[model samples]
Target: MANSTTAQALQNITGTIALVGAGKMGGALLTGWLDGGLDAKRVVVIEPAPSAEISALAAEGVALNPRQAATVDTLVIAVKPQSFRDTGAVVKPLVGASALVVSIMAGTTIASVREVFGGAVVRAMPNTPAAIGRGITVAVADDNVSAAQRATADALLRATGSVEWVDDEGLMDAVTAVSGSGPAYIFLLAEELARAGVAAGLPEALSAKLARETVAGAGELLHRSELPASTLRQNVTSPGGTTAAALAVLMGENGLQQIMTRAIAAATARSKELAK
Candidate 1:
C-alpha cells in the first residue's frame, strides 16, 4: 500500500488504488499514474487471465493480487464489457462504500457498476493513443461521487490525456462516438490522403510518409497554437489556391460535415444499443 505521507498528499482520497484489469487501457492508466508521481507500490493489479500483463505490472513494483481487498480507496475497472459479469463477482468483495470506482469499459453504465460493486461509480471512455499519454477521455459520475473522488479521477486521467466531464450520462454515447472511436476515423483520413497522393503520381512510400507526418504535425500545431481550429484552417486557405480548391469539394453540400454527422450519429446509436 502507499504510505501515509503519499496518501496524505490529497484532501479527499488517501489510500491505495486497485486496478481491476491491467490490459491495454488499464496498463496505460497504470503507466500514467506511475509517471505522474503516484507511488508504484500503491497500485494493486487484479488481472487473472493475462499472466504476461500481470507480470508487467509486477515489474512496475505494484502489488499484484493482494490478499487484502477492502483497503483500496479507488477501484478502477478497465475490463471488456462482455467479461464484466464474471469479473464483477470477483471484484465485489474488494469494494467498500468509501471506495470509488472509475471504469473505462465502453457501454458499461454507472448503474451497472453500482449494481455490481455497490460503490460510487464513474464511467469513462478513453482512446487508444492513451498508451503514449496523447489520448482524450470523457467521464461521468453518479451522485455518490465526492468532490475528492472527482479530483482524484481528474488527476489520474490527466496523466493519459485531457479530461472532460459531462453533466449528463446521456451525452456519453456522443462522446464515445466522437472521441472514443474518433481516432480510427482520423487515421482513415490519413490513409485516404496518402492514397490520393499516390494517385497524383507521388511515390507510394513518400506519399504515405508525407500524409502521416502532415496529419501528425498539424495535430501538434493545433495543440500548441492559441487560435481556434477554424481560424487555423482559414489561415491556410487563400482565395484561389490549391487548398481552397480542395476545401470547396470537402465543404460543399453532401460533403464532410454531413458525412461525419451521420457517422457519429450511427456510432452514438450503436453505443446506446450496447448499453441496453
Candidate 2:
C-alpha cells in the first residue's frame, strides 16, 4: 500500500469508480484520487469490513457497499490475492464492458484479470513506501487500453511516487523482486550499519541515529542529483580513503551485488509460483 500522494491523475473521475478494497494501498490510492479532484461521490468502496479510515472517508460522500451491482466506469482490484476468489465473483459483473480494470495485487497476472473480468486491464506493482508518497510503481497494460485509460492509470500510480511502464508482462516479476521488495534492502542496510557501528564501540543510540540519517540523507542526495549511483559512489571514494575501504568490502566478490542478485532471483521465482 502507498503511504502518500503526489501527482494528480484524474481531474474529475467521470463515473462510479468502484474500489474493491480499502486496506492500506487501496486507501492510499483513494485518498490520492479524492485529493486530486475525483469527486468523492463518484467512488464506491467495496470492503466488506471497512477500516476506521475507510469509514471516515464515507462521510465525504463516497459510497460504501451500496449492496447492488451497478455498472461502474472503472473497477480497481486492490484486494488481496487470497480473497480474489470471493471478490471476483462479486465484482466481475458490476463493471461495464467499456470499463478499465486495474489490478495492483502482486502475483495476479493480467491474463488472470482479463479471464475473470474481460476488459481493458492494467496490472501494477507498488511498494509499501507509497504510504508516504515515495514509492515507485511499475505497470503493464493490455493492448486494448485506450490512451486516456493509460493516462488515468499512470496518474493513479504516480500518486505514490514515480511510475515506470514496461511492455513485457514477463518483466513484472523481476520488477516486483526489485522495486516491490527493494525497500527492505535499504532498511536492512541501515539496520546492519547501525549494528556494525555499535560493535565498533559507539553507543547504540548514536549508532542508530547516524546510520538512519546517513542512509536517508544519501537517498535524498541521490534523488536530487543527476549523477548515476555509480558516479555518486565514485565521487565519495578517494584513493585508499575510508569510503573506498568500505566499498572494497561492499563491492567485493561476496558483497552486496552478489547477495542482491540471489535475493532478487529467489523473489522472482516465488512471484512466478504465485502467478500459478
Candidate 3:
C-alpha cells in the first residue's frame, strides 16, 4: 500500500526534516510521518506556542525551537496564509539552500514560497480527511524541483493519503475548490439531509443519525466500489420508487447540479482572489 511505501521512504531520508507551525494539518502530517516510521530524532518542530501534545514529542528526542538552525533537507510550511510572510522570514534562515520546500497553505503560490524560502518548492492542497489518512492531495512543483525532490515531496504528502501531481499550476485553483473545500460541501449535504428528514416528521435525533450513517456508508461504498458514482446512484434508484420521487424534484431544472456548479465556481474564484 501507499502508506507502507511512505514509511519506507521516510526511513530512507537521511537529512533532518523541519516542520513549521504545528496546527491541525501540520499535526496530522506529523502524526502520519511518525506513524509511518519516520524517526523522531531526525525531526525538528518550529512552533511558538506548542500544545501539550506536540511538546510531548520532545521527550522522544524531537527538537523543539533550538537556538540555532540545523541544515534541513526537507522543510514543510503549514502556517496560515495570512501569517506566512512573518513566519517565512523567521524560518528562512533555518533552511539550507538546497532543501526541498513543500507547502500546504491554501492560496499560497509556488513563486510566493520561492520568494521567501528560495528552494525547490511544491505547493499542495489537502482536504480535512487527511486527519484520518483518507485525504487526497494535488501538488505542483516549480521547474527548479528535481525529479528526486519531486518524488520526495510525493512520498511526504503520501504519508497522510493519496497524492496527485499536475504539470499546470493553474489547475490548483479548481483543485482547491473541488477537493480542499469539497469536504465542507459533503458535510453540508449531511446537514441538509438531516434537516429534510426532520421536515418529513422523523425524530430529530433519529433523523440526524440516519443522515450521518447514510452519507458515511455511501461514501465508504463509493470508496470500495469500482463503479462510477452515477452508476451507483442508478443502482440505488428503482423506477417509480421513493428515491425516484425525490429524484424528480432534485433532478429537475435548476436543481443540485446547477447549484453545485455555481458553488464550485464561487469557491474557485475566491481561491484565485486569495492567491493575489
* Alpha-carbon RMSD to native, per candidate: 3.4, 2.5, 1.2
Error of 1 at 202 (Å): 1.3
Greater-lDDT candidate between 1 and 2: 2
List, residue by residue over 102-131, the lDDT tens digit for candidate 2. 999899999888888778999999998878
Scored against the true structure, residue 187 in model 2 reaches a CA lDDT of: 97
Model 1 lDDT per residue over 80-120, tens place:
89898888888787778768889899988889888888888
**Ranked by TM-score, top first:** 3, 2, 1
TM-score of each: 0.92, 0.93, 0.97
Global CA lDDT of candidate 1, please? 0.84
TM-score of 3: 0.97
Best by lDDT: 3
**Which segments of candidate 3 are over 4 A away from where they belong?**
66-68
Candidate 3, residue 34: how far the Cα is off, in Å:
0.4
Model 2 off-target regions past 4 Å? 1-8
Lowest-sum lDDT 10-residue window in model 2: 1-10
> Between candidates 1 and 3, which one is better according to TM-score?
3
